[model samples]
Target: MLISSSYATSPIQTYKQSETKPQNVVDEAPTSQGDTVILSKPALDLAAKEKGREFSNSFVMQVANQSNQKAEEMLAAFTYGLNNPLIDISSLNPATGNGATYTRTGQPVTDASEVLFASQNESLLKRNEILIAQEREKGTSAATILEKVMQSIDQQPQSYKDKIDWSRLSS
Candidate 1:
């Protein structure tokens, strides 16, 4: 079976196994040609990638004949970080029991990196708000209202054309 995982954006999948002769287990109904495609472990792994595997997050591969759900679920395993933050695995010794062990608990990020990133994001958002307020103060135009006005005028020509009033008589 040929299976592949591609960029984060693509759905992960296992390769469709080449048709092998099904042993003499007779079935009542005939199966579709594609139904013969067997789902294997590799395919499931690919499925894991498909789900939450950001293309930039890991080595990406491209596979076919699989759904996106499976891949993403699998990817969740890798992305799932431990909840206990005191023991940073990135710089700890697990065997010596000095480093942290995974408690399967989720931790709210208190790292300086995360804080600074969030602060920067908030800063940028504040700047954006000011820019938008200025734009609105300038009375920036929206196309939707203009479109409606044009449509109404087109549908009712008399509204724009000056109609001759016969009731006024030949003045």
Candidate 2:
């Protein structure tokens, strides 16, 4: 009889070997259909166009949001400019940066007050355009639309009427 030696075997690895498999392990989840769908050139172009339209819509919305903020600022400036005085120092400070600063007292020259007047004129013009479009859609007469606009203008404060430029309103 001879003595036998017993040796324990090494344990098996639970994880996969990198040498046999890929280093970057991608998820192999099951899909409802296949992994990829083949589309014609026209279909691809249509999808791209739809995506562009979505982006354009979003950009228009962003512009509208900024316009609303600008409108609000114009209103505030107009209200403040009513009682306070405004000054422009562009002659003295020729190199001064563009933009108005609000303080206890207003400026002497072109200031927030000017901005208010300009912006109000532009806004009124835009409002007129929209109002005309709306009235036309409802089959309203041109004279009726003019009367409506006049009535609305009459409802505004006399102080505002005096400050805002009325020359552009005719056009």
Candidate 3:
């Protein structure tokens, strides 16, 4: 006697919202490491595409916010040509049943993140320069000016300190 199972399940998981919450509220948010359901190749492709789109949107908005005045035009200019990344879905492996690796173009994302840090550093430096000039105008002693600058620097997040051009403030 020979027997075979012919059931195939799509990789999509559906969740019903709890009655206590409004229809607009979700019971549980889908996280990056959430449970996985075996889905069709197309469904996987769609999911990857959606994720890429979401990431691109968020990254552009964040980068735009780093502008000197957070201008909408600056945001548009900075995000020119930035688009949803191409997500590659690797073929499923038998060793990891119903598992596939996702790979996306990362260079642009990395560069954008760097831009955010650089912008923040630039802004900090500009503010410090203004404060230093104001102190000089008030006939503040060099030692006192340096002390004030150091205080301002200390107030900044630790990560940005190394990137600031400290020598500029001294001169």
Highest TM-score scorer: 2
The reply for model 2, stretches above 4 Å from the true place, is 1-109, 164-171
Better model by TM-score: candidate 2 vs candidate 3: 2
Write one digit per residue (lDDT tens) for candidate 3, span 31-118. 6656667899999999897553422233223433355343334222222211122112244344643322112211222344445645
Specify the highest-lDDT model's number: 2
Report model 3's TM-score to 2 decimal places: 0.30
Q: What is the C-alpha RMSD of each candidate to the true structure, in Å?
A: 28.7, 31.1, 23.5
lDDT of model 2 at position 152 = 47
lDDT measured at residue 140 in model 1 versus the true structure, 0 to 100: 42
Clashes of 3: 3
Off by over 4 Å in 3: 1-109, 162-171
Q: Cα deviation in Å at residue 54, candidate 3? A: 44
* Per-residue lDDT over 1-171 for candidate 2, one digit per residue giving the tens place of the 0 to 100 score: 011111111110011111111123257878876768899999999989765342223322233235545423323332232222122222344355443322212223245555665666566656666776797799875444544554444445443354332111222
What range of 10 consecutive residues in model 1 has the weakest lDDT sum? 162-171
**Candidate 3: what lDDT?**
0.37
Question: For model 2, what is the alpha-carbon lDDT of residue 71?
Answer: 29
